[model samples]
Target: MNTTEIFLLAMLLIFTAPYLVWRFCKTDYFAPLVIVQIIGGIVLGPGVLGAAFPDYYQFVFTAPVVQSLNGIAWWGVMLFVMLAGMELDLKKVWQYRRESATTAGFALGVPLLFGCAAAMLLLGYQGWMGVKGKNWQFLLGIGMACAVTALPVLVLLMEKLDILRQPMGQRLLRYASLDDVAIWGVLAIILLDWERMGRQAGFLLAFAVLTPLFRRLMARLGEDDRWYVSLIWLALCGFGADWAGLHFMVGAFLAGVVMDAHWFEQRKLDMLFKHVLLVLMPVFFLSTGLRTKWDAGSYPVFFVAGLLLLASVGGKLAGAHLAGKMLKWKQGEASIIGWLLQTKGLIEIIFANILLDKQIITSDMFTALLLMAAASTMLTVPVVQPRLHRESHAGLMQQASS
Candidate 1:
């Protein structure tokens, strides 16, 4: 078939396979549709499908077809990241500053340290660090990736758990918001290119100077106008950041960060988020899968993924328990909180993709991170749902007794 036809075929597979697996298998309890799509991407990727059926993989995913898919994937992720930035509820975090800061800090910091140690151990070996990477950059990037929380995915899971509008869910959002900021800041640090330092510095300076002006303009515009102008703004910021060597997604995020949620109707924004996932993000996941490599060997990649999972889950839980103690949270609160916060999801995959793009981590490392991300996300709902049910039951029982 021709390139266009092949691209369409690839698209059909991308959308159909994951939904079928998710719906028919009824994996929603443990793994959501998003998780299943991610797994589907990996399965459909070069490492799995391509490795098994080289001729068919080559026929379907030719150079031109792959490039087209990447174009779609890039825009999809940029919009998704920007939406994530807009979703940050800083107002709520500020309202509960002490608890929010403490929990977010431990939640991010402990995993960082754990992940850094894991990176250190990998440093003594080979096939993990990228060719262009410095030891420090690799360590920090990997550590941050491990520490990172997928705020978008966390929001989805909370909604699924029926706590999205509840006090506890709001609290989790506050924590994730703060961590989101920290994660991106660390990414900028990791992406720092001294040779183009001037460009990056100028980008930040310009962003700082223009952010308020952008906000004022946005506030004055009608919603429809805001929607049109935000897309234009997203394009410009993405371009500027890419030109400055910081990557376009950073700019995409900054574009949305300054824009308040109140600026757009919440229902519309939520719907847009869902639609983006339904339509565009599966392409991103498939492209992400194509980038995966087992050059470091399959067994080793799986082993490292397991290690990262241990660090990620263990550190998140430990951090949550510590925060629970400090905040005097009720019994069992930490477990639920930790489990909720531990999910890495799409943001983690995006983070690893950026690292791979910049060559801070090898493709093997990227694969490991990807596997760890998928597992962490899949683990979230199953672990948290039962605990939340018990808590709800107990709350009802207590009210009856009272």
Candidate 2:
């Protein structure tokens, strides 16, 4: 088959396989379609499918076809990240400053400390650090990866749990928003290339100067025009960031972060986000899976993944429990909050991909992180549902008594 046909075939598989597994298996209660797609990507990757069927894997995922898929994945993730930035409610965080700060701080900090320790251990042994990775970059990158909260996926899961519009949901968003800012800021620090330092500094300076002008221009435009121009803006920012040696994803986030969410109609913005997830993100998931490697062997990767999961889950829970104590949250609140906050979804995968791209983390380490993220996300709903239900039941009983 020609390269175009092969690429189409690849696309067909990317969309169809995951949906079929998700729908037919009815994994929604435990794992959402997104999770299933992520699993599907890993399964289709070289480590799994390629090992099992080398010739077929090579035939379908030829160099040109893989490159095409990569192009799609890059744009898809950039747009996804941009939307995530746009979703940040800085104003709301400011409104609830004390609680947001306290929670977001613990939520990010504890995991980072734990993850850094894990990275140190991994680096003590062979085969974990990437080829070009320096010690600080690897440690910080891995540390921040543990601290990441997939705000977009958190929104989806909260919506699924029917708490997205609740007071609790809004509270979680505030915490996550603050962490999102920190996550990207830390990423810029880790990605800082001394050789390209001047270029990166220039980019930030230019971004600072242009951001307000961009906002003013956006505000003056009609809604339709704003939407169209935002895309143009996104592309330009992403290009500039990549050129500056900070990844395009950073620029994409910056592009959206400076804009007010109110500029776009909420419903339309939401629908477009959903459409992007449905149409484009699965390909990104697949590409992510393709990048996974078990160079140190599958068993070792799983073992390391288990260790990272322990750190991630334990640190998040500990941090939340501490915050709850300080804030005087009700009994059982911390566990649910912690588990929910521990979710490492698309954003974690994206972080891992960036690390891999920069060679700050090896493929084996990437695979481990991927598994950790998948496990953490899959655990969120199941763990949180029963607690939420019991809380609702108790609330109803108390209301009846009153």
Candidate 3:
């Protein structure tokens, strides 16, 4: 009932939930631990069990607790971005430059077109229950959502499967990374009002012109013994962006990209990020789950959601697969790559949550997008692993014959 007691209880739950899940479930089910932590937060919050044990739940889910957890999540994302940047191999990208460019372009362009089209049709129908917005903004939002690819999840999967060092994996990772960068640029463009396009254009030109100078400054600062300088710079970037009407996360991401040139030591960055990922990333997803509120919207909304999910999946698969074929990949390998690239995991949900928080999309639309992300991720492993394994075996067999 007391503050200290509530804090203790929350800590107990956080520490024990993994153990409990592991004890009851198979080792393969460990991924669900992240989900459990999130659901636990919701159950213990004001939404469900909190209604019954008001005192205990309220104390546990206090504003301070939520804020603290959110801070951890943000740090986790920062580390994730850093790791992603560290993984960038300019050599590999150069090797597959044409293929990577084509794949990234198709992956992004197809989805953007489909999403915008869907938004136009859906927006005209005011009776559509779950959808949000009724004009160009809605179309832009939908297109943005559809264009997202979960770079963090893709990188983690590639690393886990030991494919990060492979040619195919390298290509996929490069394309995905470029895709993310493109999406961020697109987001910046989308978020800008038409009237402010000139201002945005000027700002972008200025940022571009200053990027080399900024990189040199970061490199110099990085050489200093005081690592806190990076943190200070990060804070200034994030706060400055917030003051300039953009989300802090955008600033954080751009900051990571800028600092990326200096932080090229993968091993050191990996060690730092591993801790952050294991501890703080889960909290971010948990907070996300806690904040999500799903309710029945209009039938049209549900229909549109279903359609949007289909369009998202299909567009990515078709576009990526076509690009792969154009690059002379075998049919099965191309299919596998397409499926792998189709996955939308925590990163996509994080973006959706940002849009939701900004009131750019409705709750129903958020729920639908979340569902799409979960489905895409769940489908990826099953679809790609077997095919890739077979290909690996065949390659080994050919080597033996030679």
Q: Which tens-of-lDDT digit does each residue in 248-319 have in candidate 2? A: 999999998988889988999999899999999999999999998874255889998998998899889999
TM-score of each: 0.98, 0.99, 0.82
Clashing residue pairs for model 2: none
lDDT of model 1, residue 246:
96
Which digits, one per residue and each the tens of the lDDT, describe model 1 over residues 1-402? 788889999999999999999999999999999999999999998888988898999899999999999999999999999999999978888999999999999999999999999999999999999999999999999999999999999999998999989999999999999999999999999999999999999999998898888888999999999999899889989999999999999999999898888988989998999999999999999999998877425699999999999999999999999999999999999999998898999999999999999999998999999999999999998888889999999999999999
lDDT of residue 120 for candidate 1? 98
lDDT (Cα, 0-100) at 36 in candidate 1: 95
- Cα lDDT for residue 21, model 2? 90
Which of the two, 1 or 3, has more lDDT?
1
lDDT (Cα, tens digit) per residue for candidate 3, span 64-121: 7777667777766665654454455556667878877898888878877887877777
- Candidate 1: list runs displaced more than 4 Å: 295-297
The lDDT leader among the candidates is 1
Number of clashes recorded per candidate? 0, 0, 1
